[model samples]
Target chain A: MSAESITLEELDATERFLLAIADDEFVTGQRFAEWVTVGPTMEEDNVLSSLAQDEMGHARLWYELIDHGRDLDTVGYNRRPSERRNSILLETEHTDFGDTIVINFLYDTAETLVLEAVAETADDAVGSRATKVLEEERYHLEHATQWLERLVSTDEGRRRVTASFERLLPRSADLFAFDAAVGTAPSTAGILSRPTDELRAAWRETVEETISSLPLEVSADALEAAVSEPVTNGRAGEHTDALTALLDSIHAEGLPADHPASGYHA
Target chain B: MKLEERIAAGQLIESGDELTDEYRELLCGIIQFTANSEFMGAFAESEWIPRAPSYQRKLALIAKNQDEIGHAQMQYQLAEDLGRDREQMLTSLLAGENGFGNAFHYPADEWIDIGLLAWMLDGAAMQLQHSLMKTSYGPYARIMKRVCREEEFHIRHGEHIVREYATGSREKQERLQAGVDRWWSRAVMFFGLSDSRSEKSERMDELGIKPKTNDELRQQYFDTYVPKLRNYGIDIPDENLYYDEETEQWEYTPPDWEEFNRIVTEGGPETQARLDRRRTAFEETAWVRDALEAYDGTTANRFANNITA
Candidate 1:
């Protein structure tokens, strides 16, 4: 069988890759959406809301690429928290606007590197979906960087932004630690052009470049601390208390069991 | 022709035109009121985003909230152009000195309540805003043109749930009915005082700011929702509600006027809680705003609502 032909190992690699990226997006989208009504300004609220929708839509797009024989709702919303593979960074509760900007900046930077790998290496479906996500993700990076610049430019803003980076950056190590297969198996299967460790390194450099330009106090030592990874590998289905709580609200009980995906009316 | 004469002739009011203070003030007032309503409504409905039963429902609800917030942005921009700052408007809302659409002050206790909110209550608001698409205020009419289009989708989002539950298992039907009962009176009071008492709206109708009177809009709401709810076997909760064939009006027992006045002035069950939510959020993020202001080399924003200051 040729590389492009069907292979169990390749399919396993692909599914793992997609689930990791899609779960990251899905969880991040939910966290971003919680900012909808109460951002620092109305304009930022709208922008953050749009970004949330984009991430969720991206999640749905990636979920659609899976052949799990489950409906999109089940794939996207019904999975147990123990089954989800999102980074703990994405799952953590946003403590402040500083957390919002820092997480967005950190997450989107890593997302760009990962998506670019899929876009560069994978063919057919994965490549096309990655391409589409990368386009929407361009603006997300801009939104993050723009906010970071503004927030880091003030004394109080800089203090909070720096503190948020200190607290959240270490958790972001999970971004590249989705699966042990992540480091070499996906690229060998021709699914990603580069391995996870290489992408993780690039991710740090890109994030460093962005933060260095700003007046943020995040240090090289702290960046190296973020490199110490996989204390809780998200791909292993271990999660924080936040993910469990998020699942309870999202896949809520008391909804009619017979409710349809188009809503029960359909 | 003078502004009044042009207004009488159904001329569309545009910005930058010389106008009587009354027309301008009235225009600014309604615009501010609407902007506040959209802002408050978006905030109220957003709690359901995490709780929507399906992923599609969740996304649709978020999109609906986004539209409301977008509408608030446009409305606030128009309000700002008319003389008030958007920051002041937001500060006023948080301060609770400004009143918004009364329906949002109540709590949506269940997903069913959110369903009623979008279907029944938003359906009620669509009646008034739809007519405002033809309002004599050109800027407002244009905004309403887009607002009503989005609102139509919101009502359908609501109706989808309403129909599902109303026609579902017995327990489902009971929950739907319960939600209808809770929201019905609030939806009715959304139109405000009746024709005789609503002198302010009468002036608005004359000025073409509100092209329909409160009673007329209330009747429109009844005409649209009554039969649909009845068909779904959801009770209207107003036993006194009936169409008077001879007068061609919805003749019903009005909602408790004293309660209406109290909710309007002092606010409803969730008003303080929701406002406190906003107040806490605002205070929590003051550093973000200050940082932006400082970075932009501007003084810290002094939002100047009389009540806020």
Candidate 2:
């Protein structure tokens, strides 16, 4: 259905879904930025930093589409961790280049699937925004996939990549764990053309196929275990210490307490 | 034509061109030092990216850091044209076999120091770089034009932060003043020693490799910043700092050349830590590079072919 035909409750559901995506982008961008000066090489350093900027830019675009009245900083920095809706996977600290690549791969793969669904939505605002974000997400996926393939070629490199996948894959559950309202409202109202479960399934197929192609000893049982694991649904407001600590750090640094509401209306 | 004859003619030397051994060494040394400074400077500033007080500040810092990295890339490419490989230059830097500016040697301890770095340190750098916009080497001069343009925005960003803190709460003002006190001497020393003490100054000038003496650049820096800092109520740190009307110059207590030599040569307080971080990153990421080298090139070529198809 077109946006004009959707009920107010359905619009609210769509807004919540967009918030989760924006939060994921903002938090991940902030995390990626920590590598600005310290990337393995100058070229990689520049590329990663550019990616961080792009992610943050994507977050701004999504945040603008919501009915929230807050500016980007107000929406991004002023929120308490408990109020945030980003996936727990994004908030985990990266311990190595391998971890970075894995997270990038998983998140970008999931994001691409999610954006595809959003692109088919009848809501013109979300459909158009998804189109713009997908253009950038394509390169993000390419970057992550290229690095993943390359890193898995050597024994030691393969070890790191495998370890990162094992530790992170379980956390990928929440990327698709939309709440009942957000999960069904859009699709039921015909605002979204695809169900969240279909997008989730597509994301899993892409991720598993890519991992299976890598020259590693990852087992089918481990992959199955990761896929079936219970999820900490961030869309329903559940999060981990990582997001809490991130928000605490941001606040401790003295960002202004009163962020003017963006007065944004979809 | 002879090197000195070319110098007299004021002609730009193109890439892949030959010059006297002395001239080539001098040019390479200058450009490499500059490139290293850009890299090290960005590394130092990256420390504050996470701690930036606001989202706008965080974005600005990251953007500036990226610009510095780009500057380093351009300078390194120029140095490569002059026959220096990046690996050798970077390895030498980590080994203390290469050197950069002294200002970067000191720690950027707080947010105020970041402001000081952007305003004063970068301000000092711009004086020298602005002069090099017409440098004798064609490639280096062309790169400097771009570097100078980005640097202009950096200085404005820095000045905005400085002004914010300078006019902020008493605590912020105190921090800003303290940051200035710590950095003022180093900023003055950034231009190196007086012309009379350095014989290379005259030779470099004659070669047209250096168009202005260090003392002249230092004075120009002083002329530009002194009034600006005073307007912000920042003390210049040097009690002896004064303008000589007859000489049309500002004179101040010279920086501790002994300390400058020691820090740049022996490494400063944060130098070892910063180098250790860079070394660790380089070593850890070695596998990534190795993996790329070992990967089959045909795979990438095939992927591209599929795209075109």
Candidate 3:
């Protein structure tokens, strides 16, 4: 089959975007799954494991969407780190459920914002995929918000959460960092509502406005605009020490070269 | 009494209408006490799930911690049913206004602590829970019956690890003994003061929730475990520990109950750090909760209704 007949440019953009999103979800979700037997309480274990599994499911859906029909063993597991674009936020492993909760919520919010923006794209495949994710993103946002409020309402909880948020807040805007992989800038390519700095700003408005009641503020008043340039490129294979250590422990066994291509499934 | 007959007969006494004001106060206090303690313990124990040494152990540790949370839920539900709310339990625990379980207040330390806790502390708990399986209180006893089954697995899991270290290399043996040494005093303390002098023993015994006194239970522990320790060539931490054939019970140096009481109430070495972690996670996700609560009323609820239809 001719490539153009089977794949839309928008679909191609979506396949790329979803792989990164799915990878971020899967890695973080697997990390969180480590807490299954070890949660602070039995109730928290069930809840955490369930969420971890949900993230795996999220990854699965996106994988199928991006599944170009290569062996999973080859493309999913054996690819060099450069071909993977999952954000660094999801890669850092913190055993503390508190850290897990904080990290995951921040990512869920940023992801939801980006996905919703893409849902409005003129391309049917991109918009359709984005729409599918929008439904699940709502639940993700809700779960994160609930725990965030519970933490902030108390003095000690507020202190700990604020610290974690500060650590993560600067990194979140990096989700929209454009690479050649994301296919030239919207201005350069003349695409509608491509994920530009402007899109991130609108997302900032939506998030900051919603969380205004809480103590969180961008590091400075100008951060909403100025922080668009990422201090680190998690999507470009740059990662923190924590991410490196976590990957070493998790993928202790390297994948074979012939694994299927990594992407979301249903 | 036969276990089944005792369980059956006690089930009758469980439903009696003689709930006096003082009895209500006492029972409510116990329910709240155990519920709060379970929450604090559960929060601490969960840290072990990810760091467990092996795949099989990982699954076992997870199951044990899961059962613990389930036990907490059962206890909390009973507390709630008795008129105390989840909010009160949460407040009492997070605020440090109530008792948390003893072992959980301490960090798991090394992998050996997992085995020691399972073998000894859990064994102690099972003894108590087994008695409580026939407890006078209806709901608490019923919950114990389920919890006891899971507790058995915990005991065996603990045995498996301890035995592994005992029979393995010298390094493994050292690790095993070191774990026991670190945990031995705590295990003794876990059963509480061996004193026949304490009012707690009198109160629990009179209520029929605990059929044996703390000292008697400690003796039972020594009798059951000392010979086993000897058989495995694992030394008991307490030098003075010995079993009396005449009394058909073992005796040992008593743990510092004052310290036990202190640690369980005020924070222990790891308390502040763990609590800080819990609080941090909760605050970081407040927006998600808010969004969820908001959508629960509008988009989410509507979607649910649509799906159901």
Please report the candidate that would top DockQ against the real structure. Answer: 1
Per prediction, fnat is 0.60, 0.40, 0.10
- Backbone clashes for every candidate come to 0, 5, 40
Model 3 stretches with alpha carbons more than 4 Å out: A1-26, A33-45, A53-89, A92-242, A245-266, B1-18, B54-60, B195-200, B264-267, B271-309
Can you give the lDDT of residue A195 in candidate 1? 76
Residue-by-residue lDDT tens digits, candidate 2, B195-228:
7846666677777777777888999999899999
| Cα lDDT tens digits for candidate 3, A17-43 | 566776677666657767654444335
Q: Which stretches of candidate 1 lie over 4 Å from their true place?
A: A1-11, A181-184, A253-266, B197-199, B299-309
| Candidate order by decreasing DockQ | 1, 2, 3
Residue B31 accuracy (lDDT) in model 1:
87
lDDT of each: 0.81, 0.78, 0.61
For model 3 chain B, give the 10-residue run with minimal summed lDDT.
B300-309
Clashing pairs in 2: A1-A190, A69-A261, A69-A262, A69-A263, A70-A262
The residue-level lDDT of candidate 2 at A253 comes to 40
Error of 1 at A43 (Å): 1.1
User: Per-residue CA lDDT of candidate 1, range B1-309, in tens?
Assistant: 898899999888798888788888888888888888888988999988887777888889888898998899888888877777767778888899998989888988778888888888888788888888888889999999999988989989889888888878898899988888888888899988887845677778788888887888899989988999899987788788898999998889878989999998999999999999989999998887777776777763432111100
For candidate 3, the per-residue lDDT at A115 reads: 72
lDDT of 2 by residue, A103-165 (tens): 998999988887887788646777888999899888888888888877776788998888888
lDDT value, residue A190 of candidate 1: 79
